[model samples]
Target: MEQWLGSLIKSGKRVVAPVKHDDIVDFAVISSPAQVADDYVQTRLSAKQYVFPKAEVLFSYKKDGKDVTIDDVNTDEFPETVLWKLHPCDVAGLEPLGAIFNWDYKDSLYNARRAKTTLVTFACAASDEYCFCASVGGGPGNTDGSDVQVTMLPDGDALVELISDKGKALLTDDIKGETSSADGIDKEKFIAKVEKKFTVDEIIKKLEGSFSSPIWQEQSDRCLGCGACAYVCPTCACFDIQEDSHLHGGRRVRSWDSCGFSLFTLHTGGYNPRTTQSARWRQRVLHKFSYMPERLHVTGCTGCGRCSRACPVDMNLVEHLTEIASHE
Candidate 1:
């Protein structure tokens, strides 16, 4: 692992990997392989930040007298990068994000970074109670958006599957792995061992008419409106564009926003469509389970379970979904 990471860095490409900061593990740019952590189940934040930044200056402007000069932030400056040690679920999470950004109108900033980034994902060997990857049509060995999928063998070696042209470009003669069909036999078995509590399809079917359900209000009553779910989510694409101005200069910035907050649906005329916590919660649930899947033909929830872990009130998504499913 060290040698492979070092090879990537020595090749003059920026390498981002899971780094340990105290008790938390998150992906960050690493100069050396030693900075990578080994004992992390899932990253605190997904790898989506590389493609879609949390906040960025879109353009800057200056005003003097009556003339205004505008300067756009360069979207083409992204360096060739390798995202290593990402879990399969996180890799699959990027699929929905890419779909939304490229659905009707293409986002040049997102496309530019995605074009330059190569994803190297590690298959999950185990899972926790909060994880429902299989339930959402994903597994430890599922390779949806990964450029290269890597499965750990019993002998401490890796079985590498090159998934795309970007994945193939990073391969070197020193990297030894089988890219043939024989490698999948064991991987399928490994994936078969993974168990999910319930199917996302079942939840989606239940969510079809749940907009007026009383369960949303009951479940969301304790929600602090912290927006942690959207912040950590890999597929949540809501953002707000704002312009910051001084006396003579300013910049237009794009930052992440969340439907969990009341201000998200606020109108300039002092009316908010989603006025109550129940309405906001319903939007969050429906957006992922109903709306996005209906539009993109892909499930918005990746079942990574970060939102459940990060929730201050212990608002478990699986539990709520299961309860909703049981309702008539």
Candidate 2:
């Protein structure tokens, strides 16, 4: 794996992998294989930033004496990239993101970046209690959105399975290994070792009647309104746009925002729609399980469990969903 990564980096394609940054492990561009972390079950942030950045300058404008100029951010600089070592669930999380971006209108910037990247997924060797991939129509080895899926055998040899033409193009004749096929490899058996926490049908059914339930307030009263959950989520694509202007010129900037924050729904007037934490929390849950599935034909979450793990106040999504399921 290290040899393959080194070869990719040497070929001028940017390699982004889970690398250790102080106490947290997040996806970062790597110049060498040594920077990749081996100890983390999941990264602090998802690989979505490679396509959708945290903050991006959409366009810049300048004015001078009845003259104005508008410039778009250069799309030519988006590097040919490879996302390595992300889990299959993380790769699947991109599905909802892609749907929303391409829904009403096409975002050419996102499309350009996405077209140049290839995802290389590593099957889970183990799963923790926080993981609920199976409950959300994904599994440890499910290759829903991966270009290539690599499974490490018990003997430490990796079986690289190409799932797309882009994945096949990545491997050249110079890349050598013990070549084999995925003829008898039952990845589902490997995934079955992990226990499922809930059923998707049951949870969605329970949510059908939970629109006005007081359980939202009960669960969200303890929330600190930190917005950490959405920040770590791969499918949360809400963003806020702002214009920074000088005396004569300015630029429009787009930055990520979250429903968990109090200021998210604040209006210019002294009115707020989703005013309380309970309302915000309800939106978060419904957006993932209800609204997204109904409108976009895809669950807004991939069940990677990053939101639960990153929540400082110990908000457990699976526990709340299970509680909602048992209500009726």
Candidate 3:
């Protein structure tokens, strides 16, 4: 694994992997295998930032008297990147995230980054209380969006599955080991058994008529509206565009936003559509469970449990969704 990572770095690809920082595990660019975190169940944040950054400048502009000049961003300059050690749930999010960016109009910025990025995922050998990937069409060994899938065996050897042409390209002859058949390997025994809480179809069917349900109010009463859930979520693509202007020049920037914020639905006429936290919370759930699946043909969540884990309040998504599914 170290040799392969080193080879990618030597080939000019930016290798980003999970790194431990005190109690927080997050993705960071690494030059050596020693820097990668080994004991983490999940990173504090997903690898989505590499493809879709938290904040990015779309274009720059300059004003000369009455004349305004616009300089479009160069997508050709985006760096080649490899997201290593990502789990199946995190990789699965790329499908929905990409759908949102490409459905209405082709997002050149997102496409550029995504085209240059390679996903190297490690199958989950363990899971925690917050995990529920199996409920949302994903599993510990699922490789929905991974370029390469690496499953570690009990004997310290890894079972490398080349999932795409890009994945095969990353394995050089020097690092390629003797290929062996996985015919008798019980992969299920090596991976975590995340219980399926509620299927996507169940959640979608329940949410179809749950708009006026009082459950939203009951579930969101303790929400702090801090947007921490969206910030850590792998599939949350909501963002706001703003102009950073100076005396003669400025840059148009896109920054992350959240539906959980009270002001997210505020109108320009001082009228707020979602005035309460309950409505905002409801939008978050319905959008992911009902709207995205209906419109994009893909669910907006991968059952990563990052939102529940990042919430300051103990608001578990799996429990909430299960309750919604059972609601009459």
- How many residue pairs clash in all the candidates, one count each? 0, 0, 0
- What clash pairs does model 3 have? none
In terms of lDDT, which candidate is stronger, 1 or 2? Answer: 2
TM-score of each: 0.94, 0.96, 0.98
RMSD of each candidate relative to the true structure: 2.1, 1.6, 1.1
The residue-by-residue lDDT of candidate 1 on 1-328, one tens digit each, is: 6777788999999999999998899999999999988766778888889988999888899999899999877866779989998888888878898899999999888888888889999888767777878878888888888999877777676778889998888886565552345433567645325577678778888988777788899999999887898999888889999989999999998999999998999999998898898899889989998998899988898888889988889989878877877778
- Candidate 2 clash pair list: none
Q: Give the alpha-carbon lDDT of every model.
A: 0.85, 0.87, 0.91
Tens-place lDDT per residue, model 3, 1-328, is: 7777778888888999999998999999998878999977999898889988999999999999999999999998998999989999989999999999999999999999999999999999889999999999999999877999999999987888899999998887878665667777777788889998889999998888788999999999999998899989999999999989999999999999999998888999999989999999999999998999999999888888999999989889999999998899
Better-scoring candidate (lDDT), 2 or 3: 3
The TM-score, computed over Cα atoms with residue i paired to residue i, of candidate 1 is 0.94
* lDDT against true structure, model 3: 0.91
RMSD of 1: 2.1
